[model samples]
Target: TFKYVDTDHDGVMVKGELAAVFDYLDVDHDGKLSYAEYTKYDGASAESQLTHDVFNHFDTNKDGFLQRTEYVDTLFSQMDHNGDGQVTRHDYDHFFTNVVHHEMHQGHNGR
Candidate 1:
């Protein structure tokens, strides 16, 4: 999943590489995502509230659009749970499986 998100193959996930994921989520192809568009993203699933919160957290500029840097930073921060500046497989899996899944299930009621 990390490889897929890191579209640039730059050996590290950067703002540019994260644009691929943003593009995928921006279903309207408007170059920016509104709250409605974000909710519709496939990754959103039943965790619409958490997804919404995540989006807001990443919209650092507060312009209601998630710029590339914000998106990349948000994802990297989440993946690097220990704040050790490196995302180990254990950290990645913990965030992916536990954090994301927990949020998703919370919204879906264990759908």
Candidate 2:
């Protein structure tokens, strides 16, 4: 999935690549991602509601919208577990397997 997201094949996820990802998730082509857009990956089920809450957690500015900068920064920070300032495939895998799973579990538990 990391390689898939790295459309530029640049070994690291740059802001532009991350923006493209956000655009894909936005669905509506709007500049910001609403809860519906953010949670659309799993359809309009309960899981999507949980995912929406997770998206809100990423909205650090509390603006009720996910700006490109916020999405990129949150993704990079989560994936860059080693603090190397780069999100390699290894980091992405680690993040997807560990952080995402943990977050999902927490969400399921209503944390």
| lDDT leader | 2
- lDDT, candidate 2, 14-39, per-residue tens: 65677777889887777778866765
Clashes of each: 0, 0
Worst 10 residues of 1 by lDDT: 9-18
For residue 16, model 2's alpha carbon misses the true position, in angstroms, by 3.0
- lDDT, residue 88, candidate 2: 85
Residue-level error in angstroms, candidate 1, position 77 = 4.2
lDDT, residue 91, candidate 1: 67
lDDT for each residue of candidate 1 in 31-111, tens digit (9 for 90 to 100): 777776666655455455666656765687899887655666777777777677666556667887898777666746845
